[model samples]
Target: MADYQQIFQVSRNQAIKDVKEGVFELSRSAVIFYPKEGSFDCVARPWLTEAGSRSARGIWEIEFNHKLLRYIYGLTNQFTTYSLRDCGSLRNPRTIRLYESLAQFKSSGLWVTTHAWLNDRFLLPESQQKNLAELKRSFLDPALKQINEKTPLLAKYSIDDSGKFLFSIIDKQNPV
Candidate 1:
């Protein structure tokens, strides 16, 4: 966990530097979670503090609304930590989201969903990629390929009679 924190710190610093250098602009409102209880949003922009400053005092910190701290604490307590290194290495956001979501199913290692469900889950606009074949070509194949090659887990996907995608994770140690 300490190693992950270090990695996160390095990545965060680089992102901050990039934003400061005008490499890219980030959205003012970044939402982390939206549960029934409340929502957690990130501060629009964060700046480094000078030495002896009151808040954060010489360190770079992104201020979040108070709700986020509670949300993070609850999340940490409820969930087990998984290696972020592999997920961070993924270039595709969809792949990373899918990988993390699948990690939640470590016990069963199986997930099934329709193309419509996948489109909604990944937040792809309906106007884009209308058919299953197109979805497979543009999104599914690439994400699966990257996940299988770059991560420790292996993924196998198939289409059922109802045209739903069935994904099963193969245990690397107990391959059949």
Candidate 2:
């Protein structure tokens, strides 16, 4: 509890709330995958399963979602890393998620994604998914503006002919 408070800079109550709620909430969410077959799949199974903690017992516990067993064991194709310092500059959580996702493609300096992929990535509301302008106004444009202003990565986006959102990410530290 004290460790959580110090690590996250939160009060005792906040840390308890985070341990009881925030941590579990993130684990309860599902992962979305866009397969090479040009189809999307929603693995509704969360990556974390509930192993309810008992405060009086002096223990906090959680179990990994069964589907994550392989990855958890260290067999993986993709490895991604991000700077916590860079993420701290962003106010919106979604923007941080976007920046992290963009970082996965940093080496290539490009990311082309479909509407369905974004619909799942953002868990965007139906109205925003249906309305491109709303998505741009409410999500993309603002996130990019923050990234451009605060991070070394410069983001420029356009909706290409195939109706895919194309992002060209250029790292100022190493333009590639």
Model 1 C-alpha lDDT per residue in residues 91-145, reported as the tens digit of each score: 7788888887666665587888787778788987554347777777777788888
Write model 2 residue lDDT over 1-176, tens digit each, in one string: 77666655778877788788866677767766555564445335577777667786435787888877886666445667666555556768888889988888888999999889999988999888899999999999999999989887899899989899899999878885
**Each candidate: RMSD to true structure?**
7.1, 6.9
All candidates' TM-scores?
0.60, 0.60
For candidate 1, the lDDT comes to 0.63
Judged by whole-model lDDT over C-alpha atoms, candidate 2 comes out at: 0.80
Q: In order, what lDDT does every prediction score? A: 0.63, 0.80
Task: Report the Cα lDDT for residue 119, model 2.
Answer: 90
Off by over 4 Å in 2: 1-77
